[model samples]
Target: MASRVTMIAHLFGAMATILMLVWLLHYRGGIDLDSDSNSDRIFNVHPFLMFFGFIFIAGEAIMGYRTVAAERKVQKLFHMVMHLIAITLGIIGIYAVFKYHDEIGLSDMYSLHSWIGLGTFCLFGLQWLFGFFSFWLPKSSLATRETMKPWHIFGGRALLYMAICSALTGLMEKATIMGLKRGNESRLINFTGLFILLFGLAVDLSLSLAY
Candidate 1:
């Protein structure tokens, strides 16, 4: 069951990543969210896709932490401290998005979104590196392993949720500012999220059975 859950989470994470990569490409290619004016302040689909996309990241992080915890190779204190730091940074980032929301436009917010997304990406990237490389803790003691897990899990999960909220809020703000009803624009994002989630679960279940 645990292995199944882990695989499911990984698949969702990968699908979300693909969506994000495509969105970035479209944005770079001058594909405006609105078909008309590139500078139009209207709210569109990007926010929906970007924000909810964090779920995949969060799910994966949870699975990874559980794996480490089950191993009992590390101390909990270290993991707790890392989580505190990551949450602190994530909260600040979330606050920054709302605080500057009034002063920022949708197009401008996209820029902000990119930067914030990068922050989340960096945290997860670090987590992946540590997991695969096992460089986070030396082979010395259980205490050292415990210390590394907190930071790895907390930092990654916090950033993921932060990005999720930040993106969704930006969409709401944009819709309000432009007086445009674009709730439908978010449908694609919603569908993609569901699809990725289901697909992931299936993969995880299958993998668990095989194992």
Candidate 2:
């Protein structure tokens, strides 16, 4: 059952990523580190990275234990590694948006979406640090590990949910700012959002059912 749900989550995640790429490359212009000529191109990286890089990676990290047949230590290592990758990609995504805002002369971190997104990212980093110290190198004592286990799991789940919330809000904000009312672009945006939501839900359900 968990495997089936994980497959579905993978399918949805793939669809969301494809739709996102099509929207950015075909409509919004391809992503770049810093497209001075077109800041919109720079902005495209924000959503793609946040959805695929951060949220999707974190989702896989959350579900990997249920799906992989690895030893306990291996699974734990993989989980931590995935989260690290997610953080790297997440920070890059955040940077893209901040750079975009600067290029356009817009004030940074003003909107509700930015507030939630930045807050989530910061908390995510802190969570990773806590996890690393508690479970990874210079590990805590066995009793301490057992004591912190539940809180660790809860924090991981909570941060993933917050990331999803940020992604949804960011998507809507971009859609509204672009005034994509009734066009292929608008439809694509809506569909991407739908798949993203479905992917997150599937990930959450798969995790719950796994245990």
Best by lDDT: 2
Per-prediction TM-score to the true structure, in the order listed: 0.40, 0.95
The lDDT per prediction is 0.47, 0.89
Against the correct fold, how does model 2 do in TM-score? 0.95
> What residue pairs clash in candidate 1, if any at all?
74-145, 74-146, 75-146, 78-147, 79-150, 82-151
Candidate 2 local distance difference test against the native:
0.89
Kindly list the per-residue Cα lDDT of model 2 for residues 1-211, writing each as its tens digit: 8899999999999999999999999998799976778889888899989989999998998899667788988898889999899999989999998888888899998899999999999999999999899989765799999999889888877887888889889889989988778988999988998999999899989978865
Across residues 76-125, which tens digit of lDDT does each residue of candidate 1 receive? 33333444444444444444434334334423335554566656656655
Off-target runs (Cα >4 Å) in candidate 1 are 28-58, 69-82, 105-188, 195-211
**Clash totals for all models, in order?**
6, 0
